[model samples]
Target: MDSQTMRDLVMYWQGVTLDDEAASRLAALSTSVGKTLNAVAGGSMFDTEPAHYDRALIAMAERSDD
Candidate 1:
């Protein structure tokens, strides 16, 4: 998934504005997942499944102690 697309998804799910820093972080995660999973740009590549995305984001948040 592309960075912007990921950021858009995150923001859509949370219904919140992701600041530059946060968007960057989300974008980075998307990039990492894309690389790891061989996903290309756009929405179809990476894991965009709502439940999985939420779980992954929660896991990441927990990992960061946020």
Candidate 2:
């Protein structure tokens, strides 16, 4: 995620603010996590579906029921 998005998440989701140094570290950590997940998911792209796909399906079902 972009640094601004990361900062927004920290403030919006976590309800906290970090200093410049901590924000930069948080950005680096997010980058590292994204890279690792990409590498791991690359091989399994065809073999597996995203975990969120289930949530989407559930939401669709709920909408239909409504």
Candidate 3:
């Protein structure tokens, strides 16, 4: 995603303003996450099933409740 899209996402989803520093960090994090995900999934994000994504999110929520 582009910087503008990331900024909009942060503002809309998290209800927070994105300063230059925060935006830089978010961009870096987004790149790193995309790289890691691509590496793990053989460069295709669609390789994973949608159900797997939902299950992973549910598991994360359960773990956070601990």
Off-target runs (Cα >4 Å) in candidate 2 are 1-4, 43-66
Model 2: weakest 10-residue lDDT segment is 57-66
Candidate 2, 36-66: lDDT as tens digits: 9998777657766657987878777855546
lDDT value, candidate 1, whole model: 0.70
Which pairs clash in the backbone of model 1? Answer: none
Give a tens-digit lDDT track for model 1, residues 38-60.
64554463554446777678677
Overall lDDT per candidate, in order of appearance: 0.70, 0.80, 0.80
- Backbone clash pairs for candidate 3 read none
- Candidate 3: lDDT of 10? 93
Q: Could you list the CA RMSD of all candidates, in the order they appear?
A: 12.2, 9.4, 7.9
What TM-score goes with each of the models? 0.40, 0.54, 0.54
